[model samples]
Target: MIKRITAGLLAGTLVLALAACTATVPISPTDSSGLGSETIHVGIAYDSAGRGDLSFNDAAGAGLDRAKKELLVQATEATTEAENDQARAETLRGLAQGGSNPVIAVGFLYATAVGTVGKEFPDTLFAIIDDDSVSADNVVSLLFSEEQGSYLVGVAAARATRTNRVGFVGGVDVALIHKFEAGYTAGVRSVNPGITVDVRYLSKPPDFSGFGAPDKGTAAARQLISNGADVIYAAAGGSGSGVFEAVAAAPAKVWAIGVDSDQYASAPEAVKPHILTSMLKRVDNGVFQEIQAFAKGDREGGSKRYDLKVDGVGYATSNTALNRYKDDMEKARYRILSGAVKVPSK
Candidate 1:
């Protein structure tokens, strides 16, 4: 009886969503070309840092690419402005109504917007990365165990520091950002408990530009360095690039740990070697999986959390970049996964 009711409900939802297809935004030339016979249109709204950050946005886009090539999906990018979290959500809704197959929203900025849109289009398979939780039945929220990966980064920053003082510049002060900060601080303390960590955000409570702006991010990093932070962890996005620039110009013993993707190669040559490691948030993989599930009729909505156990998030030390620290990073990774160490989160 339960299986029969479930089948009926799903069939009914698909019917309703198809009726509302007229409400979605129109497909553009960029999204139309290269679309094959088996293609499914996917909308990816990126963070303010934009596509070439060589970081978070690029990684998420890779996942969409995987879905496109493997499953013949079509991808379109929707860029967001600084502090315009709500507007981004509306944009996601527009893409869905426009007949996009499975829309993926990157970052925690889309959480609330996804929640609202999920309710409006019950049959739309929406995938939101970086954060989770959905009130609707058809929305799949892809969240990472960022805390676990952050702990490894914290250790890297501490170990790389010459002054024994480190800094953390966060994108925002929300719970999700806080998770990064808290886990990082705890990880550093585990390596050297007395090391002081100076924490700062780009904005206060609601605004989220601490991750977007390079100028402000550079200024904050400079201040921390001036105050004796020899190493820093940048959970801020484009803002983090600023920290890299500041470190390059600074005279002190300075280095930075980048977040989201493999940033060693993305950084300028001046500070390229100074890159300790990167916190890899597998945003793209998560999105690709959800879209594939939809294509195979296995899409499940609501909140979803992917952790180190699932390779959702972790820190990476590339042999091409940080050969010296590769072993240390591996040790940290093993410790976290083995449960010998527990990383704290907010």
Candidate 2:
């Protein structure tokens, strides 16, 4: 009896030790003050909605918040429209340059503006999300794989939809939106070769003006639903709210996917029931990680892609909503992560 008890106790200890090892986070770059960094000053320039859109800007801001709270970083932001992304970046860059502070810019929209800013303020240490739209050694560009996350959502949507038709509502025709659209369309095709994907943009490809217009987004959603689309993955910033409103009013089953942040809680109750899941780009992780990198002396220039390969992008279905689909989701996820299944990034 004593021998049996000893054996059980030893087995339990080994199981707990194995669990701890499996849960350990792989080490990435680190900073000076130990917890990612000491006191790194940062300036955030985001989309037009400022901080409450619960999407890209909010996700990035969350990261900045983490840096300030956990890494002892002092941070500020430049909240302005797409056209003003560069202007705001310049304003922040000036501050960073004068006092030896680092300026962090959010959003892919800042691509064009940040590259020039990096050139003018070579010492400012410009870290941007979604790349600088070009190459610059002074700037650390962070880009994510929206397609990878969107691909998972696409699979879920295809499997869940009874209509076999879905919608893609994009903020702008920029490369970022293209990443979501391309991956979503391909994912649907991968699952069901004949599924119909209706793609629509809130604004034209070159027009950055429509990044936060909700009215246009709602109108676009209604149109997509009218044509029999039951599920839509909306990448349109604030405009996505309008899309949610439209879907909520539908009699037939309608689902509108949220992006960047956990938008499951952002919309009306009726609309949320139909939401399949969210394609989280982990912007907050990117933001905080970049700030930490700067603190850790990993200021190597050029673009750093937060792609699916690095678990940078992923799907977020409600714990309850996806509970039933966990098996399917896990299988798909492992395959993509292992490269056993290729998710097209077209």
Highest lDDT among the candidates is held by which one?
1
Supply the TM-score for candidate 1.
0.83
State the displacement of the C-alpha of residue 54, model 2, in Å, after optimal TM-score superposition.
0.9
Candidate 2 lDDT, 37-62, residue by residue in tens: 23455666665577888788888878
Q: List candidate 1 segments past 4 Å from native.
A: 1-38, 82-86, 319-321
- Per-residue alpha-carbon lDDT of candidate 1 for residues 74-144, written as tens digits (9 for 90 to 100): 55566655345456655666666666657777777777878787777777777777665555667777778
**Where does candidate 2 stray beyond 4 Å?**
1-38, 82-86, 97-100, 268-270
Q: Report each candidate's C-alpha RMSD, comma-separated, in the order given.
A: 9.3, 14.1
Local lDDT at 284 for model 2: 92
TM-score of each: 0.83, 0.84
RMSD of 1: 9.3
